[model samples]
Every structure is written in C-alpha cells, then in structure tokens.
Target: MATNQEEVKLFGVVGSAFVHGVQIALKLKGIEYEFVEEDLANKSDLLLKFNPVYKKVPVFVHNEKPISESNVILEYIDETWKQNPILPSDPYQKALVRFWSKFIQDKIVASFSKAVRAFNDEKEREKNIAEASEALKILENELKEKFFGGEEIGCVDIAAVFVAFTIPLIQEVAGFEFFTAGKFPKLYKWSKEFLNHSIVKEIVPAREPTLVYFKARYELLVSASK
Candidate 1:
C-alpha cells in the first residue's frame, strides 16, 4: 500500500481508453491519487516534460517520478501496491499475461484503428475490418474463462479496456459492426463481463457524451480522408 507521504498523479484526457486502463489499475489497487485532465489540443507542460518522447496523455507520476505507457504503468502499480495484484505471481502465468497484453495493443488496437481510418475508401475499409476481425478471432479463442486472467481481472483485462469499451463505441459511431456478439461470442461475453465490473463502470466515460465525441472525431477523419 502507498504511504501518506507518497504522491501519485495521472496525466490524461477523459476520452482516452489508454488512460482509462491506468485509472482502473490505480482504483483496483486502492491507491489515492490526483487526476490531472489534459487538453490534447493544448498540451500541458507537465505532460510534455514527463513524457518527452510521446508527449501523450496517460503519463503516471509517482513520488515525482514519471512513467509513460499504460502497460508499463500497470505493471509498476502491481509491483508497488501488492494489494489486489494485477499480474500473476507465477512466472509462466505472468509471461502469458504480458504476451496477451502486447497482442491486444499491437495487433487488436492497431487493426481497429486502421479500419476506422479507412473510412472513405470502401475496399480499404472492408479489408481493414477483415484484418481487425481476424485479430479479434484469435482473442476469442484465447478466452476460456470469464476474464482474460481467469476468474479475476488482471493486467491483460486492463490492457483490453479499449476492446471492451472504445471499439464498441467506435462501431456505433461509424455505423459498422466489427466486434459483434454474433461474430465473436466469447469476446463479446468477455466485453460485457469486463465493462460491468464495478471498477470499470466507475471510470468509463458516460455513453451519450462519449458517443458525441467519437462522432465528431470520426467526421473529421472522414473529411480528411476525402
């Protein structure tokens, strides 16, 4: 557990799914921290200084030390807090967890983003959607339990925050179906289980505003693609 003298702060934007993962990990660990909301249009000096390389949201600061990347921050929190541990203790299990987390970030998220960006081109959009669906199928096969970490939520579950929440929202905004219950039943069920968890419910952005935000952003992307 963190001491009273220890200070923790999260630098992120409200709508970022990557940022949400860090927030969920902090809450799960029962850590008390200040949330500094950043405006991406007008980046904050602290965020830039802390994450000079990416200059991105979701920079986690602990006792004046800054940590960039959501997955790295999640591991750090699990190691530091020790209570309600996010990653497994067994070496093999821990390695598996890390593997799935990286797969989600590199494979699943990347394909989904490409599909979303291929908005104006029909052939390109369908090709990207097929690629994204293929990636999701692999995840569906990997999920044999209620959550990615078996009965309990773990690092991989937190890593998939974007898949559970944001992808569905993007599907809604874009008027397409990539992560549907019919196509990927296991993944669909897992999404429900993950989203309905009390901690996740607390941190997820409200539906209406989040949809509106995505809709506006999607329009801009489509306009740019023209």
Candidate 2:
C-alpha cells in the first residue's frame, strides 16, 4: 500500500501483543502500511531473513530497512513520522513514557509469557505470579488519575491496552485473574475505556474468541505436562 509518500510494511500476526502495539502506533500516527500476517508455527523465510536474531514477528520494514522488537519499532515510527506524536515532547515525560513502555514489554509481556504456559516448576509459577502482580499494581497506580500519561492514549497507554487484553488470556490459561474490581480498579477502568475506543474496538479481535483459543492451548499443554 502506498502512503502517497513511501511504501511501509509490517510483518506480524493479529493475536500477538507486540504486533498490536506497532499497528496501533501506526494507526494513531495516520501512517499507511501493508500488514503481513506470519504463521509463527511455520515461519516464512522472509521473516527469518528479516529478523535473524529473534526471528520474531512485529518486524517493521520501512524503506527496505528491517526493524525488530515492538518497542524499538514504536520509537522508529515516532521519529520517522512526526505526525500524531505518541511520546511526550518534554524530556522527563518522554523518559517516563519509555520507562513504563519498557516495563510492560518486559514484566507484562516477557515475564507473563513464562508464567502462563509451560510452567513446570510450581515455585517458578508462584514467583512469576508475584512479579506479574507487582507490575500490574504499578500500572494501576500510574493510571489512577488519568488514562495513561495524561488525558490521551499515548505510547504507554498503547502498550497497556495489549497487556490488559493478553494478560487476562494468560491468566485464564493459568487459572488466575488479576483484574478484579477491588484489586485493580484503575487498570480495569482503563482497560474498559481503551477497548471501547472506536479505533481499538474496530481493529481488535473479539475477546471471547481469544479466550477460547488460549484456553484450548492451555488445556493441551496441561495435559501434555501431566
């Protein structure tokens, strides 16, 4: 697809959080791009060639340059296209946004991955649950007054939306629930508001379907473990 300026392509899958992050960033920036869905179970040569190190999805190819890692691609998108800027212009605010963005990518995304599926050690699972809760609590507190950084849905908010959605799927698979009303009120409210937005609602897949998919996979994994 032409952006009336240059061709942009994003390689990723719909169910992936990282991929969703980049997609939302691009949409919010009003950037046009072609989205290529990869079958991660059967990765294509192009994906391997583009991201040899991580061989992960959510790789953004801009002007023939391949950028991997969702957060890195987000930064690249902000810098490359100055329209509808996601990060704050102020240095301190930018730092805060980046910090929470990294926190979500690390604690919520990476750490929760292990916590949900293929958890062999009971102790390890407990540790992961604790850590994940800590991260969620921090996010909840940060989102107490506003919808993320301020009144708008910015970089950190974008990341949080995916985290809130996918994390529940992870929790359901692991027989856990973190977004209880009493426990994470702010985050729960934010999640509701974020998912309700026209942009997010239009782009995202239905929650029940995602839950069913993950539950089946989780059941299979649990059976295999036993």
Q: How far is candidate 1 from the true structure (C-alpha RMSD, Å)?
A: 1.1
lDDT of each: 0.91, 0.80
lDDT of 2 by residue, 146-181 (tens): 668577678888877666578767686687765566
TM-scores of the candidates in the order shown:
0.97, 0.91
What are the per-residue Cα lDDT tens digits for candidate 1 across 68-131? 9999999999999899999999999999999989999888998889878876678988887888
Q: Which candidate wins on TM-score?
A: 1
Candidate 2: give its CA RMSD in angstroms. 2.0
In candidate 2, position 216 carries an lDDT of 82
